[model samples]
Target: MRACTFVRASKEVVDVADVAALVKADLERARDTNVTFSRHAMRVVPVETTCFAGVDEIKEACKPLIEKHFKSGREQTFAIAFERRSNNTLHRTEVIEAIAGMIEQPPNKVNLGDPDLTIMVEIVKGVACLSVVQDYEKLCKYNLRMVAMTKEDREHAKATANGNAPAPGTKKNDEEKPAEAAD
Candidate 1:
């Protein structure tokens, strides 16, 4: 697997190579193996690393870089995401809204979700590529595993699969329950 490193370090555009080297060094310090560098997003500084399990490690490796580069007063949130190219059609706006909602911030206050001043990673061809998020939340939402079906839904699906009818008290439609007996 590949890892992507996004940097929100500087307002002035910085070289991709510098970002890549910073990530490589960080991963090396962590004793990561089989590492390699990948591409970056336009106007975003990112470095790709190879053989990473996931973005968690990539995020850990980036803390020092973030402190060093993104020293501006604006509180910046940096994130990393990974996926195969085949699954890359995630919508950018939806992600921003979800993230904004999660953080309780307005989307516009968060700035354009795309080309977000952070890094993103995608795994393709066995290489971890680094790119910038045009929308920060865009990549973030993909990381959300499908909402686990509600308990009711899971029970229903299980019942159907087992060829059983809904259990008692498991109404198929929403209805006001009968008044409970007085305790």
Candidate 2:
């Protein structure tokens, strides 16, 4: 589908956010150059690996991801965000709980409100696309338009691409901008 396409990059691309950032930059550049079709993308979801939609397959796929992101014994909060389309064989709770059970706790905790890392599980048909991503919630869950809509979101997205933090007070929505007085 044009709206969503699965992209598999070489090992140099670390996470979904990285692909999203690359797409965002390319889109931004296209838009700046007045490329009309640059506005076509609405969301950009990235995945590190794919597996058949089964508990065992998912567990096997998640091993390396869990090791890379959580095995260092760092205190990081995470959440499992699940999305399914044209697939209902796997229960959401079951999949989430299964993945959650695999990660070691105490050093790592689950924070639904705001997680430092997000394990994105997208089940399209019978295939499962998985990725451990940072700033999932912050980037509007990888929505291209939302991330590129405002100057602030753009700045934050850019910082995220460069592995930096957004400047303080840049998270405000467009509606929250100060109104201009009538001339």
Candidate 3:
């Protein structure tokens, strides 16, 4: 957990969405400025609440948060992202199932690829951090290095988008080499 720093922003900030919005704005600004000031900060994930690291605790913690975000008759796509470090008591599928079961089925659905809201469950040691976040995937999973793209990176991205060049390590797309005859 050397690289990970958990901060209770809700104490100062109004809501979890505020923390996420602040992060998004900072990342957007960094990208716009093309600054690589973030060296070791790989990813900065903001959780809404934290509870004792247990399935029951996690369920209890998520209940109100789930209700707040996934209201009845409100159509929304959601996905559960569970990451555990130095903890083995909690099962991945079990946690996902419990959280998914809490949400309204018809009105809300699970979309792994693109979800309107993401229930982030992070179990570190004896604490289970939970958060309902928007744009979870679009922000490169909240990766600073990925979001704050440099000029060369932007150009490579543009070139790759136009099919004018292969991405970093990829070979030429139009080139073909004849198979060597087996000795």
Candidate 4:
């Protein structure tokens, strides 16, 4: 299976060769082989190295491309999403609502999330992945993973369990203390 790198790029003026070169450079930096770029995405195979440090890096790297390719001299917004399950069924409306809820935006505004934008992603096997979604309704056809709790929430839970106190370095055992002399 070919591994693809999806980039949310600007719809501004761009050169396909430049994009391809950039993708090639990125893959080489990551020590990967078999890299290719499509009109909206990039794909690579035999990914042996790490070219992208994180999602932010990927986004940053593609910002210029997006601006170069999708810029229409109009204010626009967009989202990035990916397809997860290869066999899950999705309802258009449900997907839209889910995205809206996730982004804390109104459902109607999803389509307007980004205009003149295209979804970018790579699919392994039968999987379809688009990181940014302008239309949530389009996402209901895939099986997505459950949203995990934020780091803040986990920390808050631990602190609450510890009586709002910082975590102690070690556990104190009352059992080790002389049994209270049967008081």
Candidate 5:
């Protein structure tokens, strides 16, 4: 499975395993401590993008998908966010207008603040990763991923997965729950 790891460290220092560890730890700790956690920052979700040469290209590729995925035929809020990376000629407003015209209307009008549906267009090297989101979440600052667990740390990870409490001197303050293990 192709996976995208999301975290707050440089690409040089992080990988999928690190993100997975964070996910496992977050879930386990949340389970034990009765704390709430959102997959928003710690899980992988589908992100769709379409490649195009310019603004017109984006419209052709993204319009139909936007229509099908937009689904908010009024009674809902929606908005579009645009980003250009590859020395494009068109303006941001033009991109917004191109895509917005396809989805915006009536009660489901443009609501930039807390929109029920957020369409994001991120263009890098002429490739656009445009996606529709009901719940908007972002990667860590500067899109940094997670830091990894060292080899010496592997034993502790195995112990936790086996439903054992963390090795002494290895647990975080919030994960120091003496009441339960693998809750």
Candidate 6:
């Protein structure tokens, strides 16, 4: 079976039926309410092949779907992501590059940091399920508990490093401006 795992602080193996029931109960508990049964994941398996033949096949399979995402409806910068579930001949980097090339608009903008649309590919078993998900935030999100740090901050974090570096959580460190842009 094809599955997509999610990370929760609790790290629970969610049961789909239980989730549905809970949502329904919560919604109905509000008096007048409508509960919509949402489908979250799609599973597909190829009959002939156990895995994609090559990156070319992946690119071709993605082309038609890419059009719907880029060729119609609205125009926006995009990014490609791949989730490989099984051992496959295609290398991840090559897969992205190849598919990006096959996408109709070659010179189209690619926004790694903030893409308006994300072409997400999930290859499970051998079946390839391609989707153009506009809700990219759900796919990639930052953890609230973690703070993004710079190179200097990262270096100082190493246990082997020792220096006059201002220790973390010190009032003096908090007042200091981030070190000048890395040369």
Best model per TM-score: 3
Candidate 4 global lDDT: 0.36
Between prediction 4 and prediction 6, the one with superior lDDT is 6
- Give the better candidate number (1 or 6) by lDDT: 6
Local error of candidate 2 at residue 94 (angstroms): 0.3
Candidate 1 C-alpha error for residue 81, in Å: 6.6
Q: For candidate 6, give the lDDT.
A: 0.50
Candidate 1 minimal-lDDT segment of 10 residues: 139-148
lDDT of 3 at 122: 88
For each predicted model, how many residue pairs clash, with residues at least 3 apart or on different chains? 10, 0, 0, 27, 0, 0
Clashing pairs in 1: 2-128, 6-119, 9-69, 9-70, 113-134, 113-135, 114-134, 114-135, 115-133, 115-134
Q: TM-score each candidate.
A: 0.29, 0.68, 0.76, 0.26, 0.49, 0.47
lDDT of 6 by residue, 30-79 (tens): 22222122233222211111235477677777765666457764557788
In candidate 6, stretches whose alpha carbon ends up further than 4 angstroms from where it belongs are 1-53, 73-75, 104-107, 138-183
TM-score of 5: 0.49
lDDT of each: 0.41, 0.77, 0.80, 0.36, 0.56, 0.50
Task: Please tell me which model should have the higher TM-score, number 3 or number 5.
Answer: 3
* Per-residue lDDT of model 2, residues 1-183, tens digit only: 325665567665553346535644655554354342445676666777899999899999999989988988789999999998888799999999999999999889999888998999998888999988777776667665655556665666667789776467565353376779999
Stronger candidate by TM-score (1 vs 2): 2
- Candidate 2 segments exceeding 4 Å error: 10-37, 151-183
- Expressed as tens digits, the lDDT of each residue in 1-183 for candidate 1 is 234443455534454346545533533432233222323321223443333423344344444444454545555555434345434444334433333343322222344344345444554543445444333443223221111234365456657778786567676556777898998
Model 5, residue 128: distance off in Å is 1.9
